[model samples]
Target: MNTSRRTFLKQSSFALAGVSLLSNRLFAAAAASNEITGIQLYSVRDDMKKDPSGTLKQLADMGYKYVEHANYVNGKFYGYAPVDFKKLLDDLGLKMYSGHTVMNKQDWDEAKNDFTDKWKQTVADAAIVGQQYVISPWLDESMRNNMSDFKRYMDVFNKCGELCKKSGMKFGYHNHNFEFSTKLDGVRLYDLILKNTDPDLVAQQLDMGNMYEAGGIAMDVVKQYPGRFELMHVKDEIKSKNPGEMGGGYESTVLGKGVIPVKEVIDYGRNKGGTTQFIIEQESYQDKTPLECAKEDLRIMKGWGY
Candidate 1:
């Protein structure tokens, strides 16, 4: 064949391939845009007890496409047996992408006799609930008192993270202000936990508002560690009329209206950081119900064009 004809055919094939690739990229972007917003179900812990299935249905109807779980007792999820809740979420058109299950919660229920296999069971139950992450969201007073205590917990965290890895899930730590407020020998316990943990096994679900409450700066943490964070609990805190006598920041109002630089953090997570899921976790339901705050948050996120 002639050289000029051969080159022309090659160019034609390349043009077709580029068009196909651009079409596929547009399709993926459209799919992602279809999901309106997501919420962490801990926002409505009270309503969950009265009516678990009913509450989730309401959330789905309100345009919440994703929900991260915050309840699991024994191998049971919500009050339903393990497998059942997964089916319920599927039926609701909602995905249980993650769960906030720690080593100490209902794992020690005396009648359940499930105390011995605490951490491993936490990972397994997460799978049963269709979760990709099993998040440890708290550290008690003893764990926060010193660096050594935090280090001791890292061993357990590592063990749990390994267990999660085996089950196609990752272990993560969620935070509150206590991690920053109290420190061990001048070192912030939060930083120490990040420094010691194995990155592969442990992921950071850095609660933005809580970190801000702990006296750590928001943009500073994002800039300091580029890719250590995976998930982010998006909350906002209203500074009390008084200072020095503070309450929980996790138990703050919805996003944006409070103090956290949420939109700035969101932009960082997408362009610079490694975070995948940005979950809205509201612990305080004041001046309105939990469901109302969730709707308000969704509105705020839409307003910000996220």
Candidate 2:
């Protein structure tokens, strides 16, 4: 859909890196046992950009306890240093459980056989801000076109997972429309990624709505890869009036107010897909303001007993 956060990741100089692997058993055991409902801050991108503090307060007041960030630049999260941001969220009874940062070739040094310091710093800051997962939201176009390089980057994704394990966090990948439609050697790109990465280290945060544009069905994916998804971008889709970047004639809308079988698919995810975190994300709000949509989304999720 070419979201604002997606554009930021493309332009920002912030990079990602990895370190040695560690046992994830302990970390996994420490994961939140109860279901968590959070909002991807990108749902209110303009509000966050204008007044991060005020936006956060509004979210907290709406009864949101968790958030998933989409901006981290220059060792800061939305202009606040990691520790400061954590404190700000804590004060408002909110916690950032996950964040999106694009990890590309620049983050990895082939010669050194390791990630650059800049990426290591990204993970470090994620830990400081109490993030349970550091998710790379986009797969660069270059990496996807070549089979060899694509598989190589999948290995890097696992390496990042190992790196995050040392800090009691898990490394994750969030999908766009490409993974479902793109193929290599006749194999779907999404299948290759799931095969290459270790489940204990790397996690999948399925964006239920993003893939609709690519002819992906959330129910089919969950059934095909049961127990693989640990996180989910809870969303609903509808036929778009102004279709552009988001192809397949679809756009995001309020929960359960669209064509997607939102509740049915998410219920399946909970019972079979191993999804514990349901993070709400609505990119196109129809005629409603983003904040209005956010509030309604939270209310709907609660009503559905999330």
Candidate 3:
């Protein structure tokens, strides 16, 4: 193992020894506590790609009971078919409750006035795996550039919600910097999305870190939308080594390790922001391995009473 990985294992060794005892109680409390916390698998994307089963075992060892996925292709998650993937997680004492899949305008055929069969399959597979949310994490530039097209696509978001609801799931959208920075008819794209979509049908998975680069504040957003957000991407933003990446000039780091007031915002989400799921994500590991970042993030969140 690399130095960072070795350091992480050494630091967590004592905690890991007691994980089997604390984990069940912690996970049970999280389930009954109205705020379900998890780690987004993207934080350990490379490890997962290399060994999904092993990666999950590591996460379970770190005391994480829930996970959110960033990979799903060809009706499979991390190279396993839905059934097999679910079994893998079950065997490792982990559960994937949410996943990110980008839905674009092309997924909906305007001529047929319906979603493509491929998108439908995505929701179906998600339901089979027991996911509660099927989240679309991006919007196409073409759809956002024009007011009419944008409004039309918002309707599609609602439709997707309806489709997901049939499987006992909700369709959700995750924001990036562009939603706040970009505008349609002089109205911020994020505002337009909230105003147009049905709150009951479609949910928003707010990414606390991405909004920072767009000059949006997490406290301000939760206060404005109140109860519209059902899930949140728990993240913290720090100066990027390579600024100008994706026009955000910032990258995600471990929660509470950056400038964002993560605990305060999450407190609001739990008490009043209508957020039920908080999934931790860290994309820039700095000097640590992704698993190390994930473990630290979880530790900090538990300290904050999540």
Candidate 4:
């Protein structure tokens, strides 16, 4: 019943967004729609790595019902096996709906025309743990350089989507700044990706903060791809005194406390961006701890009626 209702709500809302793609009515109705909001566990990676139970408990105490994972390797999440980890989450009254696992070109075998066993197993395990989405958070450098290869790899994305579909899950991709700035054959990589992938199979998990590094505007992207996004990384950017990835320029701060029109974006996404999964992620906290940031981000989301 939980999965059914969750899927129905997402699919129905997505259809609404899709219908209002050319209209602004979606934004008008956005705030009234309740959305699934959660935190990306990577925001507390260090805490989790040190004490998975305690870290999860803290998040649960902060009133997070859903979570997305960024740490799953060798059939384990943080350190527990898939089944055990799922139990841990269930015990805390928390659910994990998605995960970030990097799927590179090497994971596919051109000779056999199939994904490597490892990647297949990855998808299978994700289903075992009740993940609705198995998202590859990063694309390797090799997949980005050539137009022909990139397009070919997009086909692989479709195939991965098929593989995931077997487990009643969808394949997803997360973006960083490069997708906006980088171009091939006069086409922005992000645009190409959206154009090429099948929406039913592949979902885009747009990270609003990551695009700031490339000067990409989240509002503009959402408008351009109405009803295309299913998952979103909600973050606000602040000029960072110690920038790392964006050339010492900016990093994430608490929602609404920073420069991004966080509420507006979420509202728009809810109504028109086909976004039902809003996962909070704060990579850089100025004066606050990551856990503190996580708690604050949730508080802000709740205030926004998510």
TM-score of each: 0.80, 0.88, 0.88, 0.89
Best candidate per lDDT, number? 4
- Give the whole-model CA lDDT for all candidates, comma-separated: 0.76, 0.89, 0.89, 0.89
Q: What would the per-residue lDDT of candidate 1 be over residues 185-295, giving only the tens digit for each residue?
A: 887777788888888999988878776656877668877888788777777777664342236423478787777788898778655676667788787756799999988
Please identify model 3 stretches exceeding 4 Å from their true place: 1-32
**Residue-level lDDT tens digits of model 2 in 260-302:** 8989888887765778899999988888999999999999999
The CA-based lDDT of model 4 is what? 0.89
Q: For model 4, what is the alpha-carbon lDDT of residue 224?
A: 92
Please give the lDDT score for candidate 1.
Answer: 0.76
2 or 4, which is superior by lDDT? 4
Error of 1 at 142 (Å): 2.7
Model 3: worst 10 consecutive residues (lDDT sum): 26-35
For model 1, state the Cα shift of residue 162 in Å: 1.0
